[model samples]
Target: MKLLPCVYLSAKQDPTSKQNLSAAMKAGAQCHGLWVANYGNQQTNLRPWNRDQIEPANPVPCKVLIHQYAGDIANGLFDFNQINPFLENPELVIKRLILPPA
Candidate 1:
């Protein structure tokens, strides 16, 4: 199955974060394997590290990931606002999603 990567930033760091995460996991997004990027530090943290400390994992299904992404997108919780323009025009976002990665 295809896989996609998505993220959501809490608006006020509230308890809803856990609920949102649980919902994503229940929807089959493999929540345990999240990769958090601390943009302030320019660092990325991956969970479930091995003894050798390597990043080895596969992304969850694209459908599941995209569903979670859309949820956050609708809630305006993403790290970037550049997508706001496309919020009302999902056709553009769908095109971007289908494009090959650079």
Candidate 2:
């Protein structure tokens, strides 16, 4: 099975809800590496690597891992149309899943 990172975009102010996540499971989404992060920059004493390393791992095996790369897009998290551009590569206006390189 192929494993790819998934960007869970929640329309609500908070993270993706349990209801939504449950629905996703019924639809065959197996959530891995699940965690929550509020949008925006914050101060922390821990170095980036150390902090990231401590983030919990997914106990359940899944084809997708939830990722957060909602980089400072203007209409991001609000406009659905903006999502396509945010995910496309140059020289092509396309819709595709962007998985991290192996």
Candidate 3:
């Protein structure tokens, strides 16, 4: 099987509602990590490792690398994101998860 990065299409109720994640894996989509989305209240000067750790409402299927904490910034022009705080070495883990397999 080939190793491919996967992102969880996050939803308000169910994070994996957009696609059949399990079926995709069965069809050869390897999930190295996930990009979980969970919008928060704040919208300005957001940075990684700055905000309090806020997890998604619904349980995710795999390891999460990035968390989209806020959306509709600048009047729907941009969104905010951060590295997963739970990770021991977030920078290293993210690099490993995102880079093409060696």
Candidate 4:
């Protein structure tokens, strides 16, 4: 199954960002997309825009919506010390896996 890049959006700074990213990737997430919504923050511009911003321009191919931003599955994977945490949550993770990029 092909997986899309993991996306992140946060108002506050997170110190565990890398750990979370690593956890997600290790859990089988393919890409890493970042979208910061800070007003007038140029640093936020450096990262890729969220799906909403790009959907109009370039749409994503997928049936279900993945909520990796909430850290719901990633956190559970890290907490459980699972090497392939994404596999553990097949119902939640794989169900959201999108089609391969064209």
lDDT of each: 0.33, 0.33, 0.59, 0.34
Best by TM-score: 3
Best by lDDT: 3
How does model 2 score by TM-score?
A: 0.30
Residue-level lDDT of model 1, residues 1-102, one tens digit each, is 112333433222345654656567677755312222222211122222221222112222221112111113344544422222213554545565576777
Report the Cα lDDT for residue 8, model 1: 39
lDDT-wise, the better of 2 and 3 is: 3
Off by over 4 Å in 2: 1-3, 6-16, 39-41, 47-102
Task: Give the distance in Å from residue 80's predicted Cα in candidate 1 to where it truly belongs.
Answer: 14
Candidates 1 and 2 compared by TM-score, better number = 2
Per-model TM-score versus the true fold: 0.26, 0.30, 0.54, 0.28
Q: How well does model 2 score by local distance difference test?
A: 0.33
User: Model 3: what TM-score?
Assistant: 0.54
lDDT of 2 at 93: 21
For model 4, how big is the CA root-mean-square deviation? 14.8
Candidate 3 vs candidate 4, TM-score winner: 3
Please, what are the lDDT tens digits per residue for candidate 3 over residues 1-102? 443344655545464543466566667767766666656565666655532344445544467677676655567646676776777777776565666767
| Model 4 spans > 4 angstroms off | 1-6, 40-102
* Ordered list by lDDT, greatest first: 3, 4, 1, 2
Question: Candidate 1: where is the Cα deviation over 4 Å?
Answer: 1-3, 10-12, 32-102
